[model samples]
Target: MQQNLDYQHLKAQIKNWALEIGFQQAGISDVNLNEAGKHLNNWLQKQYHGDMEYMARHGEKRYIPKQLIPDTLSIISVRLDYMPAHLTPYESLTIQSNKAAISRYALGRDYHKVIRSKLKKLAQKITEEIGDFGHRVFTDSAPVMEKAIAEKAGLGWIGKHSNLLNSKAGSYFFLGEIYTDLPLEPDQKQGFHCGSCTQCIQDCPTDAIVAPFQVDARRCISYLTIENKGPIPVEFRQAIGNRIYGCDDCQVVCPWNKFTHTTHELDFQPRNDLDDIQLLELFNWTENEFLNKTQGSPIRRIGYEAWQRNLAVGIGNIKTNEKTKQKIIATLKAKLDESSDLVKEHINWALNQFQ
Candidate 1:
């Protein structure tokens, strides 16, 4: 059965099915990530990955597709635009400091679940046409160098901020992968188009992008708020502003974002008015309320304590009236006594900002 298959034609059919099933673009790539592996080693040696030990823990499995899944000859990479049609812009949210500025990706459902489900469907479609093929699907789930794979697959180029950038879709999307034993022809890789843009580097609130392609995760607000699980370093707290979940400063300022396509995925739309709500309103959520509201959303993974800690920092950064400041202080004081040590520390820091 495999001997008679037209692998190149099959690749084209797979991409078409991916588009019909909701992916914005799909491409294939040979499994040679040696260059990416070298870069990863250098970044890991400098401890740029911060507390993300899993990044380095995977050994060569991340860069070597065959080691992760033997007999994998090609990788199918797909992009799904996630930006909803309407939301308060990040620029406006920054000035309206009372409102939370979550990374737009998290305003809707978790991309991991959304993309994984679609990838599985894509794999199933391939099996129906080509018979049972060896394949595995992933979206940030394991040791996978998805960005490098996507770039190699010609979906986009890895921009200065280290996020994959498409000339037409910008960086406002998610990537998923399907590794298979089929000998699909690889697409031509895209050339880097960010010739002289320094906007993303200069505008980063915490200067996370230390260099053009290097991001120090320790100084990244997305990492501080979502991954750190401790008190955000005092130095970066004020700069964090009202971003309670993940940050989007780099993507927000990218010149290429002007061409970004808004998503039609209803699951990517904002929920609970999170896209345009006040920090105090989010800060006021009880543990149960936080859990209930963020159910199936990416924000829920950080848990309620970190949620409070992030909101307290956001409230402290609020540029509002004296009456509002007093109310914010009173609110922090109310939670300080009963909160966990981590939350109390951030609440205390918030009260100090008022003082």
Candidate 2:
């Protein structure tokens, strides 16, 4: 009974320390993700994951925390808001065909590094208090069901858009987890509050949200622009619009996001004017320029080739004057000799858009 009381006190302390360490919210959850496992199997069975085979590689280990880390009894889930303040509004950028609409969360340094570093510090603090303990920290780097775990941890509900939605903070945040052997008392999960809203479904440019609480990654612009490596299908090119990195239409359309607080983290501030840059300017970048610009940013993970491919798609969808059209066409033609077959194909498609 004394040990139980100790754990309860530790849980409260953990939450307090999490806020001090820059996390907006933190909650504990016992590791029983059976329902989430079922949902994963169903989503994978439908092949909605596209070429992200890593999603299917982990099998049951993703949902079974103890199986992944033996003796794990509780998980500490933390939320950090990532929306940078005072940038060009997302809706305004999306409508400007010449401007690239990079997702709000990825405008700055890689969030995986930021959140992972903070989580390790939280774990270190725990160690300082209770001595050494078995614990593992995870950001989006692993195959963890982050949204599901966050929902179960009482951070928020998994909304119809498949992003965690908090009534107070909205969905523009990152989630990190610390799986531990500590027997902390779990917080109560939040109730689902999406109700009859289908705004996210209607707003998706590619109809990626096939149904409430389900998204087909093959049709998701974020997956197409970031995760996909090959030539983009001709069908979805126009709908992709000017989003050169990832899509944010669903989150932007969600009513809850109106309550979102801009992040104070300077690391999340826009770099290279990514939040509102021109497609033509990005398309003209040489490989070295791409590397130099995207260094230390999450956009770098997709590499230069995919970056060009996405920019080509965005440029193709631009509505411009004859002079601008010729300039874009000349740029596309100049890269033809250097581009790989995949990029060449996209460039050709982009050039054809002017005709």
Candidate 3:
């Protein structure tokens, strides 16, 4: 029997186990994310997260895993690739400039479910080896500074785009965490390699990046489309370009993406040809079609009315042409007959684009 528990040795074994369990990388870190806590506090004070009031409610518990989970000695951070291949995210966004550009991450099955399932399996494996440990698995659950913990665990430094960047894997991965009492040796923190690049700041179509490392979620297309429940204000709608659900402009222009590898995870691939689907075609999806097509996908969470509203904005943004203009008007009129008042308002606004 192994007499001394080699924390370092256990860490290495866990890393190997995580890789075998579909994680791109695994890292261990002691429970401290104070720097990120300050950032979160400052961001909350400035209301940068918009209507996400939960960001402010957790206080220090959000950063201190031990405070939330007693005796949390270590955090196990894991990354999984999510960029699906052969979908051509940039080309579709550029060519069909009026089409809705859902963030590449949400094109597939709900990542929360996928990552949670993997994390559950990882936790079970640890229980098998170490015999019933104090642990909680998290994939974007409340009060967890996942990115901060991951960065501290040496997964990658936070990029200017405010996403984790792996030197070998790029920034196109989802992060999940396991909080455990196991005293695994910490990994050396990854140093920031961003240098002097500001491409992500410059490439933001809606100018959401107000400063270096500061994102105003209010102006962010992703937040406006997915989180805020109301008419998208006129001021930023034109700047929103073709993006509907979430904007990937920052990531698209990042130099690091050149080294990006395609994900083999089938759940991440575009479903129902979401890749190149036209704005008019998507706008024409019946409520039933919308429900069925987006079932089990992240887009389903936005529901039908918001889906149509986003599509209406996309339709309005399209280049004015005879057939395209006619189609937009025709779609708007169809909605008028059966749409709820909120959807009708968006439909009328889109119809006005052709006039």
Q: Name the better of 1 and 2 by TM-score.
A: 1
Q: Give the number of the best model, judged by TM-score.
A: 1
RMSD vs true structure, all candidates? 0.8, 1.4, 1.7
lDDT of 2 at 85: 83
Which stretches of candidate 1 lie above 4 Å from their native place? none
Instruction: Evaluate all candidate structures by whole-model CA lDDT and list the values in order.
Output: 0.92, 0.92, 0.85
Candidate with the larger lDDT of 2 and 3: 2
Instruction: Look at candidate 3 and give me any clashing residue pairs.
Output: none
Cα-based TM-score, every candidate: 0.99, 0.98, 0.96
Which 10 successive residues of model 3 have the least lDDT summed?
A: 1-10
Q: Which lDDT tens digits does candidate 1 get at residues 49-113?
A: 99999989997999999999999999999999999997889778978888889889999998899
The candidates, ranked best first by TM-score, are 1, 2, 3
Q: Which runs of model 3 end up more than 4 angstroms from their true locations?
A: 1-4
Worst 10 residues of 2 by lDDT: 1-10
**Which TM-score value belongs to model 1?**
0.99
lDDT of 2 by residue, 1-355 (tens): 1233488788999999999999999998889999999999999999999998989999988999887888899899999999988999999999999999999989999999999999999999998888888899999877678888888889999999999999999999999999998888889999998999999999899999999989999999999999998888999999999999899999999999998989999999999988888888888888999999989999999999999999888888999999988988998899899998888999899989999
